[model samples]
Target chain A: MGPSLSIAGLEVRDPRGRVLLSVPALDVPSGALVGVEGPSGAGKSTLLFALAGLVAARGHVRWGAQDILALGSERRAAFRRETIGMIFQDFLLFEELSAADNAALSALFHPRKARAGLRARARENLTRLGLSGTGARNVTSFSGGERQRVAIARAMASNAPVLLADEPTASLDRAAADRLIDDLVTFVRRTGTTLIAVSHDPRLIARMDRVLRITDGTVSGDTTPNTAEGAQ
Target chain B: MMAVWNALPALWQDIVVMLLLLAPSVVLGGVVLRGFAPWPLVRAILWRFRGASVLFVALIAISVGMGIGLLAQERGLRQGTAQAADKFDLVIAAPGSEITVMMASVFLQPSDMALLDGVTYNEIANAPNVAVAAPLAFGDSYGAAPVIGTTAAFASYLAEGHITGRMWATSSEALAGTLVPLDIGDSFTPAHGHGDGADAGAHGGAQLTITGRLAPTGTPWDRAILVPVETVWEVHGLANGHAPERGAQIGPPFDPAYFPGTPAVVVRSDALWANYALRSDFTRDRETMAFFPGAVLAQLYQVLGNIREIMSLLVLVTQMLVTAAVLLGLFILSRLFRRQIALLRALGAPARFVFAVVWSFGAALLLAGAVLGLGTGIGAASVLSRVVSARTDIVITAPLGWAELHFLAGFISVTLILSLVPAVMVLRQPVVPSLRS
Candidate 1:
């Protein structure tokens, strides 16, 4: 089962001491499909980064029983490896590696016995995502949409409980984006995985069970479209 | 273990030392990569920047090759020259430069010097414990080959009984060296001097027949032609070192009254103590000087050894500087892939894993270059040996030895240790900022 997240007094500041992101309180239940929406420079990506414990922030970000923000950098990386899978906007793939190898890159740091399974799963994920024969091709030769799908496959390869994606479909065409949204939602529902994605795409946001809208580094709206959970 | 090590041959001992010196790098690599296999990633990086990798490796190889080639060539030359003089145990000459006489007699390099007169030669020949005292007459040439005149006993002793045919039985019969370009029974007229300045017609019609050939000695003597000393004296209008009543006898037991002076005399004794005694007795005489050719060669080798040490130091320093520059280049190259490194970090890869990737990348290049440099050194040494042999007529063989392997081991260990610097610098970069960039 995916872990629930409980956060409080979360804030991120820039080098010049200006606030970049501030979240007073937030709660995400297990297996929730949530969307974060905001204009440019609205701290949407920063929030995703903080949730993954990738940036320095002050607060309690308790995923299940472990407070990730209170842990050291090494422990946080371990937490991310075991529990959180992240997808970035630009589809950061090693250009020199084949699509399958890039998808299974985490196998490099995994235990020796676990590496083969991870690689097999990565290839399976690529095949399921419409990249069957392309798994052996280098990512540098991939189109923008194909590269984005490879990044999605990589994020899901570990079967991590919590997945945080920032603009995952921004580089894909409308048809590819729709296909990706269907794949993500079906995988989340079947596996009871919590997926929190930050995107400005209306189609993506409308499919989420819960949505949070932020403006100027502060949350402005919170709603459950299928339920009666009120705004913040 | 100590006993076992001591029981091994010298070459084996050096091989063990070379392996021991490389152990630290190997152990460190194993520890650093304890749970990780960074080779795939390292291979990718190497292939990605193969141009830079090749450039760095070539730079290292050339420097190492030059250093090892020079050392091997120096050792080969020393050994070759020493081996050339091996037969000349002691040289007795007029009160003058021992080097000049040694060169004239042992190396067959002709030079003008005062000769040891009949009295000095008679004393040396009759000295107690003197097994063989052969006069050397060297002032003639046959083409580019020097024509030396000495007794049949000395010629037989120098060849170590490896002559292909019987020793010369008459003054007109000659023994050709292995490389003299003459066949048995072939005859040649002697020139009065060496090189282009030689008087080719000076000995008009005074021909000497080749009756024997010496086995290869891998020395300057390989190109010499040997005849009886009486032949040299008679051709120059001097007495044949015998009374007229003695007839045409060519062996020894010469009459001092009829002996013509010779440029140098090579002396030997069966007993080591007797050679020292002979040297002392010959040196005490005011008319002549005696010295061990081995001792003089040792003194020359000491000087050569000192120069080799200095050259080794300079090469070492230059290699270190080049390694440092290459490592710094590695740092800049690592920056080119900073984003990829940052991405790996964000994907929850441990810092040690990334460090291993970069460090192993650098270490692989160093090791490849070092191993390839060994071949380059051997090839370069072989080529240089041929050139030196061609120029000096001394067969020098500069095979790669334990010293070059030790040098390679030390280079690999030091550079592998230094490789950690770039890995650490890469780790110190901020992951989030790099990812963003």
Candidate 2:
């Protein structure tokens, strides 16, 4: 299959003269669990931010044939809503909302998307993440692991074509992290959607279809994932 | 209207009424619903602005409510005063201000104005088109009510107010109004003068008989004690320690100047032209002040109306300024919520999401305040009317009509429209910078 994502000559710089991120060329296949790994201050998150159109960057970030970065701000936001799901390191779940509402809020902007439909999908996502029947509780009542699952549920509930999860399991224990990796791989395989995850854990990175590392503001060539971990 | 009135949850109807009044403006916002929906974002943001919303609604209620209440009370006061005078066709007193005499006779307020001579009474009665005339003698009180000394004809002019027993046939008898707490054959001694000790019983053993009680007319007459002029003369003689009878009897060659120095005289006429002519004649006389009571009432309303108009303008301006300040504060508070707005925007919400969040907050505050104020103002006015009736005989009957509705509409419209300013400002703000910060 053709690459689900294509990047070309993308570069990001701070207002000062320092370059923060650079990628010459890259392509990611659909349904691939691509992992990004980097040391502290290596511009890993910056590169992810640029790919998500959350930061100003030079050059092209195309989803298939469409250059999403070249789209107008409004259209880009709409495209992001419809196509790209984001899971941040800190878990950007809305604290004021119940877990269900936090997840359902993502789909509300879609035309003809009824509240009932969104909540049903959100409930399905929450249940898949081992958060069954916890939809009505406020997110503040949830544990850190529970909150992370809620964030994942919010990202996945909208059924966006791509998910950019930065350090998706950073705050999780080994067992919870392993479970999340297993769940994410299963979700990707079923939906045939692109999953680009950044993690410091070798166990998480090792399960990816392909892995890319950021070193000295530049991305390294891809490495094959541990087939044993993927199979498990 | 009945359906709206049924919701008795303290000012809820006022809020609903205010919203209904502002429906056209709110409906204008319906156009935005086609391409965008921001209610989710609106609901969340309002949660954060809960305290500000309370403050906003409270301000609106006081400003708008007080405005409405004052206008209503003034209208009632004006109408009640006017209706009180509507009974008497013309009031004749010793030459002075016509309104002063009308106020003294119909309103029962004691004044220092000169009293009409018995000659003036005779002249008023004999005037063209004059059907009946009755002399009025004041300066006496009986238990928080005025003792008005007039002939039997005075009761006829006070519409719908008739005696049950009889119209005080002898000088010692009296007729009390419905509010006076006296019935047939109830005898109470007269008080000395018009002061607080109305039951001081200072008159020299002049026990007055309540021959009958008058029915309620919803006017100052509902609070009076009617007696013949002879009873008052007898009471005055008892107070001053003089002879019992005011003799100058009723026959030909008898003196018409029997009750000289009587405080007032009321007349009724058949033809409008004759009444006008008599009024003109008496008004020109150096001896008497003639009042077409309606004209005097009109003058009173004109003065009060002008004052009320000024007060209304002041209230309107104050409300506008307060609303503007509230909006300005809202705009500033919204800036504090910029991070939230940016977060919503980042969540792929449209600019309308931010706008709706801010606008809904502002609108809710103003609407709540306006409604609360409306109920408070109306309730306060009603209470004040009763207090005034109990303490002084002046009755206020404030009207609620198109004018009040118009004021309410204007209030809601202005507030909603002003809220848009803050909404627009929030909508136009750069989303990315706020998120980053």
Candidate 3:
């Protein structure tokens, strides 16, 4: 089962000491599909990165019983590998590698005995994500939507409980974006994996179970979709 | 195994040293790459920047090839010159510079110098344990080949009894060196000197016939024509080295009164100790000088050795500079892929795995360049050897040897170590910032 997230006093600062992201307190239920929306430079992506322990932040970030903020960089990386599956806005595929290899990149750091299983799962994910016959094709040749699907396949291949995506569908066209949204929603609903995505697309934000609005490095509003309790 | 190792030749010993030098890099690579298959990622990165990779490899290959090729060529020339002088055990010349006499006599590069008198010649020939003391009469030529006037015994000794046909039976009958473009029974008139200045008609009626050919000696002498010393004197209007009553007889037993002076006397003895004794006894006189050709050649090699050392240093510096530039280029190239690296890090790839990927990428290029450089070095050495042999008539052969291998091993190890700098630099990049960028 996906783990719940508990955050307290999570603050990220630039080198100049100005706060970039300051979340005083937030609690997220296990298997919840949450969305973060904000203006440009409002630290939406920074929040996602801090959630993944990819950036330095002073906070108590507990995913289940383990607090990732207390972990060293190496252990944080291991935490991300074993628990957090991340997707980037730009897709960030290794263009020279085949789609299958790109999706199975996590296998590079996994133990030898687990690598084949990881690769098999990556292939299965790629096939499930509409990349069945394109496993051996170089990702550079993939369309923007297809590339993001490969990215999704990579994230889903690991079977990590928590998926943190930063503008995952930002580069895709509307139709492609809708298809990706459908895929993400279906994957989340079926597997009950906790999904935290930062996006400005209203089509995507409308589908979220709850949304947090950030402005000027602080959350300005929090609301559940179509509910009176969300107004509070 | 120890006995077998001890029995191995010096070249093989050097090869073992070369392999030992490469062991650290191999061991380090094994440790860093343990259980990790970085090759696919490394291969992908190399393919992504194929142009830069190719350019870096080519740069390394050129530098390595030129360095080792020149070194091998230097050694080849040394060995060829040394081999050429192998037959001349001791050269007795008039009181003059030993370098000049050695060059003139052993290398056939004749120059104006005082000749040893018949009395000095007779003394050398009659010395105790003297096996053969043949006078070397120079300053004559046929076409581009030097005409050396010496005894049948000296010709046989130089050829190591590997003569193809019969030895000369008369003064006019000559033996050709292996590379001389003349056939047995061929005849040619003698010129008074070498090159274009040679008087082609100097000895108008002094034609000599080729009676036999000597096997290749890998020396300047390979292009020479050997005839009886008496014929050279007779053609020059000097008395043959015999009394009138000797009646056309050739070779030693020449009466001192009838013996014309010779530029040098090549002396051999049955015992090595006798040769040393002859050199010492002959060195005492102010009239003549006796020296070992090998010793004189060794002195020349010392000078060549110094030059080689300087060239080696220069090559090493140049290679290091090129490697440094390549490493810097690699660092910049890593910047090109910083986003991808950041992606990997974000995907939870360990920093060490990322380090291995970058390092292995650089190392693969270096190793490919080094291996290709070896082939290029050998090819360049062969071409240079042929050019030198053609011009100097010394059959130089620059075979790829342990020295070149040692250089390559050192190059590979140093560059592989330096390659780590780029990998570390890549690792130091801020992962979040890079991912954002």
Candidate 4:
């Protein structure tokens, strides 16, 4: 359903031109759930930003045969709109908008998606996430767990091939985090959507198909732990 | 909103029509925003920042709307007075300023010009090409409104005027203007001097009978009480304890010792060139002043023109300040929503789309304000015009014209230009850094 990505000479630099990340090469299988594991300040989010072309970087990020980094910024943004759905760590929902409107942003601006079609899909996705009446109420009225669920619903509603979550469970409690991850895994497996989630929580990492461990801005190994080998 | 619509359908329709009329630009602006920002995103963000948006729009509407309305009112004042002035050929007065004569005589307002000898009246009537000379003597008031001492010829000058009760057949009887606010049978004391404040002592306790009422004339004269010259002279003679000799006529040896001063003389000449000749002679004379009312009006309008320029400058500055208010509002919104903009960008909103979102919000605020202001301004102008017309007898009607159209167009353009201030701020931030943290 989506392109397998290959990365080479991928590096991220800070405002003062200091190197923040330096990954020489990596590859991601199509339609797979890959967990990015790293310590604090080890460039876990920067890797995703580069792949999405949200930041300036020196890289050859080949999505299938097409080089994502070689494309211009405008085309890269367009490509991301077509292929990627991002979940921010803080769950930055537009408070003035309804939860259904929050989820419908991904396809609301697309040429082929009618407003009614996008809203219908948004309501469907939000209902699946157990937010049945969220289409009419404001987002600020929802709880933290519900807010993240709405964000996950946004990612799912876009129907994009690649779902990138930036510590989506960072602020959720133990029970809420467990429930959110379970729903995310279920949705990903059912839809065959490729998910690349970054997290340090052991329980979350223990459920991924494979874990790519990075330390000091470089991939150390394909550290697919023995505990996660039996997970669907 | 639905309940209100169901309860009062007619009121709802009226409100909807009024809103649409006030800000027709909102429809155009909505279409424009759909292309770049898409209506959903622009609308959602605008709802959050609606308070600031509404304030900015109201500021624009009041300033621009009131400015145009006041300008049109001023124009009506000038036009009405100018047209009235054109009907008179020349006004003769005591040796003083021409404007005083025009105001005191034709418009029937009080003046301080030293009264000319009744002998001067003889000179105007005897001059070649002189068709009629209606001398005006002012000294008393009926209920504090000016009472004019004029002739039977005064009625012929008005476009529509007729006696209702009967003509003044006695020296103690009076013909009232439509604005006197009295019945034909009632009586009132005539106050001496001008009618501004405390009344001066009357002429021989001059309680006169209201014999007749004249029809309306849309001039200041409508507020006056017209009396026969003999009635005015008799009041003066009675006050001075002198009786008029029974059959006296005006000439060199002023008979009956009647020396009632004439404040103004409205003269009509048979030959057009007679006006220039008469004016030149009076200009050289030491005891008399003569001028065409039209020339006096032109000089007055020159002063009004300078005032118009100053008012126009003030209007322009006020418009700029209104635009600045909109800019300030949008700047605060842009700052408050910086994180949201970054999030939208990370979620695949282009920089162009972000810029469009900021500009569209500003445009909506300004468009709404200007349209509402215009409706309010026009409404005020209409009401004020009628009120002023009734009070002053100067017909005031502010028709919708280029002044209103230009006000709306210029205001919309300037505000749209100022909107770039916030839009540029939205585009200048580094999206990745904001999304990361």
User: If both were scored by DockQ, which would come out higher, candidate 1 or candidate 3?
Assistant: 3
Q: Give the alpha-carbon lDDT of every model.
A: 0.87, 0.74, 0.89, 0.74
At residue B206, candidate 2 shows an lDDT of: 80
- Candidates 1 and 3: which is better by TM-score? 3
Evaluate fnat for each of the predicted models and list the values in order. 0.62, 0.21, 0.70, 0.48
DockQ of each: 0.66, 0.38, 0.75, 0.51
Cα lDDT tens digits for candidate 4, A1-232? 8888899999888879999888899888888788888898888888888888888889788878878789887788777776888897789888878888888876555555455666677788888887887678888988887888888777666577888888878888888888888877777777777888888767777777778887888787676656543254
Worst window of 10 by summed lDDT in candidate 3 chain B: B31-40
If you assessed candidate 1 against the hidden native complex, which CAPRI class would it receive? medium
lDDT of 3 by residue, B114-175 (tens): 88788889999998999999998988999999999999899999989999989998888999
Two-way lDDT contest, 3 vs 4, winner: 3
Candidate 2 residue-wise lDDT, A148-215, digit = tens: 88877777666777888878888888887788777777766667668888889888788788899999
lDDT of 1 at B324: 92
> Model 3 misses residue B392 by how many Å?
1.5
Interface RMSD of each: 1.1, 2.5, 0.9, 2.0
Tell me how far the alpha carbon of residue B393 in candidate 4 is from the true structure, in angstroms, after superposition: 6.4
Q: How does residue B255 of candidate 2 score in lDDT? A: 39
Best by DockQ: 3
Candidate 3 residue B212 C-alpha distance from true site, Å: 1.3
Instruction: List CA RMSD, all candidates.
Output: 3.1, 5.9, 2.6, 7.9
Q: Could you tell me the TM-score of candidate 4?
A: 0.85
Across A1-232, the per-residue lDDT of candidate 3 in tens digits comes to 8789999999999999999999999999998888999899999999998988988899889899889999998999888988888898889988889999999988987889989999998998888777899999998899988998899888877788898989988998999999888888777667778999999888788778899999999999998887332233
User: Where does candidate 4 clash, by residue pair?
Assistant: none
